[model samples]
Target chain A: MTDVSHRDAGLLRVDTDECKGCGLCIEACPPKVIRMDESLNPYGYRTARYAGAGCTGCGICFLVCPEPGAITVLRAARPRQSTAPGQQARP
Target chain B: MSSEPEVTWEIASSKPASFYSTYERKDELQHATHYCPGCGHGIIHKMLAQAIDELSIQDRTVLISPVGCSVFAYYYFDVGNVQAAHGRAPAVATAVKRSRPGSIVISYQGDGDLSAIGSAEILHAANRGEPITVIFVNNAIYSMTGGQMAPTTLLGQTSTTSPRGRSAAHEGYPLHVSELLATLEAPVYIERVGLGDNKQVAQAARAVRRALENQVRGLGFSLVEILSPCPTIWKMSPVESQRWVRDVMEKTFPLGVLRDHTQAAQSEAVPIPPPPLSMIPGIVGVADAGLPAEMTGDADVPALDLQVRVAGFGGQGVLLLGEVLAEAGLDAGLEVSWLPSYGPEMRSGTSNCHVRLSREPIDSPLVTHPDVLVAMNEPSLRKFCSTVHPGGWILYNGEASPEDCDCRGVHVLARPFTQIANNLGDARAANMVMLGALLEIAGNLPQSSVDSALGRLVRNPKWLALDETALVCGRRLMREARAEVSHAG
Candidate 1:
């Protein structure tokens, strides 16, 4: 099994200013790595929050979230060690 | 939080570059959209923007936004935007794509817009096989105008209009748009996708992208129908509304590709570019007849404003007189407007026309108070003589001006113009005689402009010669009348 504790796969950031606290991302997240904040933002709705770990960055949350800039997903770069003999790393 | 080594991160998905960084639709909500929480338009807009960004066509993309909650789409998209009237997006998109083949035109419409009022526009555009992409968002209800039943509203669904839930016997069955469009032969791609779940959303994004790609390849008539959720209108939580779209809406409108002729379809022929603006007059056979050099430039001309109203019986060329005056004004590089009002009967029915010519732009074609009035008969004289402005001129086609008629401070040129024209060989040329008197009074339109306008309008050479003689006789009579008035004074 893959190591779930390692933070190597992906990271998620939620722009609270733009999020409407729809919770669509929380429900659609495959790893269940997103949650609703305990307190509401200035718009008076509890916004989505990234759970500190276990994000695979499949971008399902980004696709399902209605807000354009609310959810942004970042995937970890592939390790150089996995490259073949003479294959240069992509910029 | 121990790690062997830190891994670098790259952005996988964010806001598309095609979207404006800040929506200027409203003052307060610059960073957010006008859509309600969990509205499908936001997601759909993102998908469309992403497609435009990927194809690198943002510069040439022209989005025809329909009348709906998305009418303000221009405020968000950083591309060419046109807001079409309710349901006319397809018609507007066809015109845009045909006129500008280089543009990537998209018609974004909702269920009520596409299927209800704009049914004919969408049908004919698709029948013609226009090369454009259409994004049809079906929420089964008119969410923007409150929860009202739409053409695509499913049976047993309650709305403001269908309070008892739609009954098949009463409201009829829901429209299956994708299936209906797939029956047509011209469409190259037609698909129905939803935003009910993660998988569905992924498919919808791919479908949206593919529709745009098909348009880029010159394939004809691609549409993607999205089964979206209206959480506010449905009175359900955002997540519950999403579930309803998957469970209930999907049963009525199945999710899948209904038509896919993209592989077999050939690219459409390149549209012929329209002729240059300067060549249009030549192509229409109006070139080089005798358009003056002044017609091309108005800067050197003196300021002039003339308003004339001509009224007579239907057969009396009253409208033709007005047309000649306006056409002469145009040939003299003046702004002109001609508006004709007449009765139904063509021969003896009363007819009148208003003409305005000015060095500056004419505001309106309507002339309520004219500076000059050409009354061809006693009835026309009595009807319009009072409406003439003070210090204006009145040309009455009679042997003598009526004593009861008010001609105070207004110059009156009363003559038997019809008798003069009859002597000149054609009584029908009376209108031209009155026009000649009018030109003498105005003194702005050159004789050359008037002659060319007459030559272009009057085809038969026999009548043309009679009209020319009548015009010269009318001018001589006007000069004599003015000289007699000066002597009497």
Candidate 2:
């Protein structure tokens, strides 16, 4: 239950330790945002690693990855609210 | 002075889109008022609209519509869309995609627009792995032009060009465009389905979504080759065409994910980051098999035209072996087309591949005349030994001595193909072993380049050495022959 982070510049991101490497994250990333490392984890599979910075961050990969609590993303930072004068002037 | 030039015009519905309107999903893109009844174009248009909406690419989307019913997709998507020339969606999409990498580009084409005139455009586009999605619709004949034989037409499907069943002796079988496209790795996803039945509809949706998703990921090429029904031409009503596409087209084209990026992601166990579209030109060599060698044809001495066939039971790896030769030719810059023929009976019956190599674009897939043919069993020999051209070479695999094929105009070598395969450990390595012999007698391939090419296929050094050894042995045994007709002279 970490924040739904959008890593790779809001494309994709995941926590490496929780990854069981079942490839659910890989299968879910449509643009192939997840990749496997060469070293196999305890499950003997090279776990899915965050692939690239091009991810559009549609949240499909985050939703479909079967491993629970494996992937996390830092929310895209939002700017603070504008002042009333700026808002009223439609700036 | 308000100068006015007299002009009068009237535009009607052209042909009411009753069929399209009926099939329209109310929840999606309501009141989309363009397209005609019994038009394959509209289905693709709707699918694209739904995909854009679901994927939310609408805000950053660009649709390249060619001169077909789909040109009106712009009317529905409410996003920027351009109508390109006839069969030039790839070129147009190429420009749009390169200029605006953030926008999702969709190229929609019909049979004539894609397979016939613009074949080269799409091939080179996919070959380059442009970050674009192509929706190729095959409806057998060209409905827009009053029905002519398109490159994707089935063997028996009658079109204007072939009033009689498409004679393989002439027109040949329908082009398995998806199968051909699968050979290239640049495309991150490729799938084929028929829109005739409910099952195929669901499968098509999955494929479309998969392709669209790949785009969202910024993966390279994604295409969904759909076999839609053109009732206006096939002498069938819209419903009948749908049924025919379901029963017949699906049987021939078979519905499935030809190449699933997601599956590749699974097996790969980790995601490989795809480079940006800006670097595509510099990254062409980054494909699975790196850029091929330079093949300037033998100009001083022309090479003999050859048709090569590799045949065996389904699991025999015969096709892979043939691909090595084709890639070798590709390296040599020789024209090549690899074709396979099969029904429900693949393993139990005869399974063969057709490879035609020339100095020019291949006009036909059927190898009417083969200069060299490989038969891995008695059944293949029985079927194709007669088809070999007079003075052609035949390679067969037999446990003991050579079996008499009793055909004319060709020389047959019945070697212990299985025994050699056993020595290699991996029986599938037999195909590569067979390739060695094929290159030897045919002289169509450079053995060194082929060895280099095959190296990319097998990773295990032990297995790799065995294939090389088998190739060397077969190369040594090849019966030498004098050049007949060379392309140069």
Candidate 3:
């Protein structure tokens, strides 16, 4: 239960433009969720990568990365509020 | 405003101002971090940003991130930042602040990056009073490379390199860098703080802020040397590591200010007012821009008049003798240099020294070949016996009597250094005894100069001062044997 409070576990994003071929993220992820691609980015790094639902978004990938702006973690969207303030529709 | 610490955390009374990401939320705020959970780096990063926001110097500040665990410092700080070469932040910061005098530069460095390869760079920059702020995170061991023994590792502290805890008599004691830099007149602020508790962490934050404030005031060379924790490398929980730094490490490295000019109104080291940025030299060539030696102004180090190498085991005082010889030569108005080969291979491995003594200028201090070889072990004799200059001496440890036939044409002295030290009762004295014998045989020091040099060295009354021991032992070794008479046909 305490794990849910971890500030770093969130939705993830990627900054492809700054990504280098260095796959430190793929290596660091505990879930084995990310992989590299043959296609290269503008920086000539085989900079493309992909991730899956296995990404619990620990952000260790974001942390261990050498390249800045390469990894992003986006939080899950909040549910929209009802028309009435402080109210929710019945289940 | 200087030393008083600010609050660490505050829950939103309502909500943080719009467009300003909340410090705790995991949404857009997540973009601010690229760090592992439970990593102590997170705490440091947050503190730096908080201090920046509080001070409102974000626009003018320039952060320097060197290659290390903290290399991604540019990511979190919403300011201009440049990446520096590995172990070159101090040098890079030195250049940046000089180039853009209006811009405040801050160097964020780690133990290995700052104190290992970049030691001299840091010393020289601080010595020159460079107007830059340096945040040195000393985690006792290197974190970026897993864990290696950093120069500041405490004696008996374990690391990857020192699996058997560092030995004080071998790896030597932890370097007190803040204390060392405080000795220099260049730095205006110096402090060492740790983050073991709420109080200590708050103090660490304040130390960093004090350095930043000094930069805003145009003070030269402000440094906050933080004793940070690398829980992953330290093999402890974050809490335990914090306790370790606060408790165990703090025993050796006490908290509080090492030096702070802001505390007092007047100090001997007032910040030198900035010169017009236009007048300052830039990255490119600018000759005669060399401050007259009058500024760095000291008598130039003369050229090496003699070159010697001392090779021995880890326990032997081989390196100390080499440094002492270099200091003595320097005292005698001769240019001198001493280089000891001590890398990952220092213990139970090949150990040697390259000392160059010159009458003119010494360009390169490394002795690829030796004029004299002071060998205290079989390896030293076998390796360096061939390199000695013709008609020069090889001072081999007399206890190990290797046949002279193996080293043909090389003058050899099987001097009993250990036996001499036995007379002295400290086994370590053999190195001094060997050095003393060399002085008698080498004749590099003129009779008049040798006594003056020896007298200057020993008058300190400090027994076992390496240089003094070298001098006395050198004299005694000469006395033990008659000076080899020069033979002429």
Candidate 4:
């Protein structure tokens, strides 16, 4: 069975194999969180990759991506606070 | 190292859902298109496919692909597809949409197909206000046929034909299709868009959708002219091609809605009602005279099937001779067919016609090997003499039969038909003289029928009299030849 790995990260994942390295997305990203990787994908064109952090999940990069399904954005969810037995939970 | 799943939103991709599962041209590359990377066709095709999907007219859609780089469009679009001849997409689309009014017809054309060979087709189709959508892709060069100079080739642009760069004095300026069509009164919507930057691509997508939508709304003709990028032909990288379209092409062709007569077009879209079949005879001025007596079948006439080929130079009335024979055969109650062909030169060009008359239902209108060859000139006689069937007749309009044309099992009557007509007072009656000679020899149709047909065709009494005399002289000549043969035997 194919594994569906779940992760919590406020970041953008580039399907490096599908990218053409047109760099339009790099220009479109307001926070400048995307960059072309030095290593080429299987197709030989240098593909885009997400920087370590600073992604606002604005999705402008996805909006400007000429190739469909090449980039996906995952937003960081609000952290859950652990509630003890005697602790009053804040609304 | 395990973490909770993160919430994410999926943005719509540029590829449309309406694209076929795999391009028919290549089954292995399902995700890949045939177009080169960064080609604007891929983007334009995506925009069109998105529009088709958004409108949900995939079932009712018909895409007409002409001869061009996008000729393979049918392989990608999951809809009814029709491939048209080079520069004939608009004409084929017009017929398709007119016959199937409920369907959505899209004529996709390139600069070469639209502006060059098919200019008249597109212009007339738009002028007629045919309810169809035309997606004109302007790439400034003919990419499909090896980057030849197209009508829309920009000045100073180099191509295979314009290797030294196009000069304004030599190649003229690029054609503004949207502006040209806007000058016409009937077109409902005309817009020019570009597949340049992201913003321009978005606008081009909207324009494509609007043009298709206008057809859906039953509005009149709509065209979306897109300035697309041809990276391979332009010898530029994909990104550079897009940039060139934005920075360079836009300077020549500004993007905007040239005209939008949507509301006015709606009123004109009412389908023209066809006249009743009963009114056809009246419209053609034959209501009083019903189907010719021959067609009504008052037979007892001999079983006759005649095929006649008439050929001559342009001003010689060759087609008229065939028409007269065909008309007389019709009057004689025989099924008749006449087909005429002429060269491009209006005067002094070769002209020819084939006529068939048969008691039985005619098989083919074309007479491949005619039974009777009436050559009104020496060239036609020499050219077609070999094609006549054995034991057939050759009536050449010359002084004497050419040497080496003494083919056995054939009768050749070489006479100066023009001189004979001149003796009869009008050289124009030469065709009539040849017809009379043919009728006298064949006797397939009665002389009275030929006379009546001539009367119907020739309204001028003076020419008719001269033709009648020419016909008699021709009959006499045939009789004299037969008598001389009998005397010699």
**Among all candidates shown, the one with the greatest DockQ:** 1
Candidate 4 RMSD to the correct structure? 17.9
Give each model's whole-structure lDDT: 0.87, 0.65, 0.67, 0.80
lDDT of 2 by residue, B387-450 (tens): 8889887888875323465656676666777777777676666776677778777675666667
After best superposition, candidate 2 residue B21: deviation in angstroms?
13
TM-score of candidate 2 to 2 decimals:
0.41
Candidate 3 residue spans exceeding 4 A from truth: A1-91, B1-32, B263-489
Please write out the lDDT profile of model 1 over residues B371-453, one tens digit for every residue.
Answer: 99999998888888889999998999998888898878899998898988888888899999999889888786788888998
What are the per-model DockQ values? 0.43, 0.01, 0.05, 0.07
The interface root-mean-square deviation of each model, in the order shown, is 1.6, 22.9, 13.9, 4.8
* Candidate 2 Cα misplacement greater than 4 A, ranges: A1-91, B1-34, B263-489
The TM-score obtained for chain B by all candidates, in the order given, is 0.59, 0.48, 0.51, 0.56
Candidates sorted on TM-score, descending: 1, 4, 3, 2
Could you tally the backbone clashes for each prediction? 0, 15, 15, 1
TM-score of each: 0.63, 0.41, 0.45, 0.56
lDDT of 3 by residue, B1-489 (tens): 334232222221111121124222222334334443235566566566656766787787888997776776665566888999888898888777866777778899888888888888889998997878898888888876668898999889988899999998779889888899999986788999876665666677788787887777776678988887776688875556767888898988888888877654232343345666566665345734665353222355432367798998776877867876777777767777899974231112456789888776678988866777889887778777878887677888865447653666666677677776766655667877777777665555654555455555556544446444555775666654454533321
lDDT of 4: 0.80
Q: In angstroms, what RMSD does candidate 3 have relative to the true structure?
A: 17.2
List of chain A TM-scores, every candidate: 0.78, 0.60, 0.65, 0.73
lDDT of model number 2: 0.65
lDDT of 3 at B36: 37
* DockQ score for model 4: 0.07
Candidate 1 residue spans exceeding 4 A from truth: A1-6, A80-91, B1-3, B276-489
